[model samples]
Target: MNDKMNLYYLKQLLNKKHVMLVYAIVKMSVYICFVLFVFFSLFSIDFRDMQLSQSLIFATEEINNSSSLLPGVSLGYKIYDTCSSTTMGVRVAMALINGNENSALNEQCTKPAQVLAIIGETQSSVSMTIAKTLAEMVKHFGWTWVGALRRDDDYGNSGMAAFTEAAEQLGICLEYSMSYFRTYSQEKVLRIIQQIKSSTSRVIVAFVTHLDFEILLDVFYEHNITGYQWVGTESWISDSTVARLDKHKILQGAIGLAIPNTTVTGLKEFILDINPLKSTGSTIFTEFWEALFKCKYTVQNDSEDTTVCTGKEKLSETDNEYTDMTLMPFFCNVYKGVYAVAHTLHDLLGCNFGTDVSVNSFRCYGEEVYFDKNGDPVAKYEIINLQTVEDHHEFVMVGIYDSSFPAHNRLSVKMASVPVSVCSESCPPGTRKAVQKGKPICCFDCIPCAEGEISNMTDSIKCEQCYQDFWSNPHRNECVKKEIEFLSYDETMGILLTAVSITGTFITIIIAIIFFRYKNTPIVKANNSELSFLLLFSLALCFLCSLTFIGRPSEWSCVLRHTVFGITFVLCISCVLGKTIVVLMAFRATLPGSNVMKWFGPPQQRLSVLAFTFIQVFICVLWLTTSPPFPFKNLNYYKEKIILECQLGSAVGFWAVLGYIGLLALLCFVLAFLARKLPDKFNEAKFITFSMLIFCAVWITFIPAYVSSPGKFTVAVEIFAILASSFGLLSCIFLPKFYIIIMKPEKNTKKQLMSKVPVK
Candidate 1:
């Protein structure tokens, strides 16, 4: 009896199923006759809720209401919810491609549907998966240097992997890759925010759905992290909910790829006119109405907190989500997707509308809908910036990313409308980059170029060295010609020294004239008038040689000055030494048994002077032939100026010349000191001793001053010493003799010379 009842129930159930199957076929055939073209749209309706679904419905209504595209034909669409899952998205895409909503694993579209194109799987991972299954159609939109933020699921991971691979092949750099979950922990969201804040990339390509990004934005708002240039996919790029977030300032100046939005005339009025009573089939609209009015629609199980709707609530006055057109990127994508299918069908069907030839391309609104070789719509994305208009933050049309343009010029961003974020400030000109340790390439220290080097650009890696004849300016930005410096006659010190040298020469000449005029005078004759004349001539030469040290040095002057000065001074000192010996021998000859006077007579005295002077001449000759002083440009003394001076080529040879002169002077000084108390009027021994003392003192001081001095001062010190010593020699030896000869005629007599003789 139970088997008989089961068979009757099964027969009745089968009969009802057959009737329903026939009804479904009859309904599908009737709908297919009216549908001129069909396109499928995949969205994350479960995760993103009503917003994603509403975007497609509103876009379909806009296309259906428009009379411009497919004048007589109607457009139809089928949408599937992926629940923000890549696997679901793939299944939905494959089902649409195979024209079988129930087919889970169909490789080919055996039962091909009339669908022309697939609009989207809003999430990046879902879209990437669909695109990969659809023959890598993502390459149609070229993007480089993008930061990826993906969901921490199979959808996000696989999508990010595909994008990363394709980006690498296209030479695109992934600045950062972060992951988030649908039900993310606060710690994870905070960590993602911190990573975004620390990343140097300004363009963040978010591969998450609307809800995932909303959570991230909430964390970003809490931390006050902003100025991230978000390159959004279709998911949240056009999501009106993100614009309605409490802190929308975080998204200001963000740029993203968007479906070019067109004015769907009366779409706002259509959305505003919607009510739960009028839209009986739209359960999402009823939910939207309740959320908008903060009221309940049903009275069956009403709670104390649930307010009953008056049915008079205005969507314009309420917290509505679909009023603004700036947040309608997804709506435009669906609208274009419908038109893309209509245009493809219109071309494939050979539909003639006022033309003999059928149109292969169709312009829907302002966009030209055409399919590429891969059967995907020609990728045309609008670059939208999240800008503030009045008090409302919304997407502003800033630029376009057209696939038709060249790769470099494809994405045209309005830099003025975009905000920049970087790890470090740009290093200004005149500074070079010093990379910070343990920091990103963008984070670096600005260091000024080193001495003699320059950096003319911002963030230069290394400073360039200036040319040999050039130097860096104060700012180290450029090279400037070095100042040509030399010991010239126009300088103040040079003029003063030149005047002093001329004066000393004049004084020496005057003394020479005085000694010559009084040649026969007893005082003059007593000092040996010939030796005095020769000494005066040598002193005049010494004063004139100092003039060389006052002017610009040259190769000729460098060699001339040192050699002439050395030889002349030696001649003068030799004359003094000759006089000292003459004085010693003259007094000793008066001692009756002194044979020393015979050994050194007037001829021998001349011979001794020549021999002593010849030694200095030999030393100077060796100095000139071996390593003579030459003009040198000294750059190390001062940074800005060159010291044009003579370089003493051989230190030993130069000192040898001075040492020889000193030896002669020291010997003369010692011999003169021994005979300083000679019992004779107008004794020349005291004058020689004093002159040698002054000469030694001047030279001793010159050594330190010369060594310590820099640039032209070194030359000045040597010249001053030469003039002082020469003057000392001329004054000490001849002044007293001139006093007696010119002023005291009686003292100049030979009797006066013998008056000071000591009685033994």
Candidate 2:
């Protein structure tokens, strides 16, 4: 968009009269004084800069509006488009100065256009067309951000001021700027030292004299400050004394300007060609011969301490600082200084710039010749570093900061992490960064994640909340699954319950074996051994069913635990009811005209037990098919863990199963109570009543415990109730018969079994 706009504006300017009428055979004279603005383009090829003809017009208008500035010398402008070409710019410059557009090179010229000053060609190449030619300015050490320092004296102050103006125009930011003279107090010097240490910039640009520069090197050396890339001016940058004083190697990597040295072509032959014999009248030439051979003239040579002088000594064989041209650029500076005076004198007399020129008038150093804004002898400088060469402090030329071009190989710097040394370090993992008041966003405090929260990444902005049924680890770096709680068989309570359950089943099996062995004995037969065996079998199943609840709650275990318990308990109760009915029928048979014994015989007794138990079996099947128990994770009960347990799918189904078992137990308890005082040797109905009472009591207490127990304990309580009730029935109904068979052999007779004892 900007390119298009600029192109359109330039096209408009091309159609204007003042620009189109710039050239012709006709002498179109203008009386007004003009400042020619030779510009590159509406848009520049280098994106960093844009040169506009409109700005020149604005500046001329502003200057003309201020009468106090020019004092009625109205400044108008003849703007020329150089098209970024040095060729066209040269033609325009010659025409403006010679006072006519067509006759630019006519030496016998007339002042016609009255053009006073030229404002542009904005491009460097075009600007130099007016001043003959030019090269690139010094290719500085690639630093765009820096800290500035200078001496407080006039020379250092003026040098730094020029750098400051250029730095602002070039868009470089100064982290800090300070100045101190050699006469400053220790406290003031310390403050400058503190500022240097505090600012994060690694590069420092110091424009100071050798005298003031020594102060900084000493202070920084004493404080042991190193790793700084120093940018120094020529005054102290080349000083050998300062480099030697940097003993701790504080400024070893420093880069700065220094006077250039050169071995000019044909210089050796030029020296060898000179002869003192030809210049015999000159005493200085004879003195140079004495110095070259380390000797004195004939009168002084007679002294034994000195060698004789030979004016005919071969100068080609000699090698020294002078002959080698080690300080050639310094002498070249002197040469340029001479031409500066000559140029000044020529300009004052209106002499053309082409005459009376020396190698000094343009750049004539190194291997090339060039012109720059800072004429030189050119701005010829070497980029030197303070380094340990050959185990001694040496000033070595690393590159050039001079007007000599071809700088692509010379201009290089490591563009490493610029802001690595921030105000504070990065926040570590498991912690969040918190910015403090009046501090930059890069600077912060690291705060650890709070309880139940975590930060998994380094330098996290905030901590995250853990999900439900999860928790944060010790380092607070991540969320993990919470520990699951359940009554696994490995735990103490589960182990104990399992042991009791297996033991009860074992004891019941032993009783059934003894009853089978004593099937012919009266005590066993009179008490209905078949019914006793069936009751013991049901009680063993009751004990085994509790084992289902003592493990990790799963879908199968959950359904098996409750269903098996309900059916086995019901079967046990049905056996007790059947025994209680037989006792009542036996008591009624002894009464007049009673046939109750015939109706409830052995086969009938078995059928009654099945009929009653079948009711419970049906209830269990309905409960399981409709709404069964399944495993669930209860997160609401605890904030830190999950309670992995069985959840009754339908509350109504669970309660109905328990209620039916309770009804059967109550029926047995009622029938046995009435027949407890029968006149028989062994009234089993009284024991049946006691066992039913114990079963009812256990389950009565169990309901509340099952509801109130939490987590794994809830499963434990159910197992406990099952074990307690099973043990009650086993001890109450079978232990006495077991004692008679094993310990009392006489009670096993039919005579003792048939003997009746009246109840009170």
- Reference-based TM-score of each model: 0.68, 0.52
Q: Score candidate 2 by TM-score against the native.
A: 0.52
Worst 10 residues of 1 by lDDT: 19-28
Clashes found in each candidate (C-alpha, N, C closer than 3 A): 0, 0
Q: Give the per-residue lDDT of model 1 (tens digit) for 419-514.
A: 444445667778998878975455678999988899999768899999877999999999999887766789898888889889999988998898
Per-candidate Cα lDDT values, in order, are 0.68, 0.65
- List residue ranges in candidate 1 displaced over 4 A: 1-79, 91-178, 186-241, 245-391, 398-422, 483-486, 591-615, 635-641, 650-652, 700-709, 738-746
Itemize residue pairs with steric clashes in candidate 1: none
> What digit string (tens of lDDT, one per residue) describes model 2 on residues 511-549?
888888888888777656678888889999999998898
Q: Which residue pairs collide in model 2, if any?
A: none
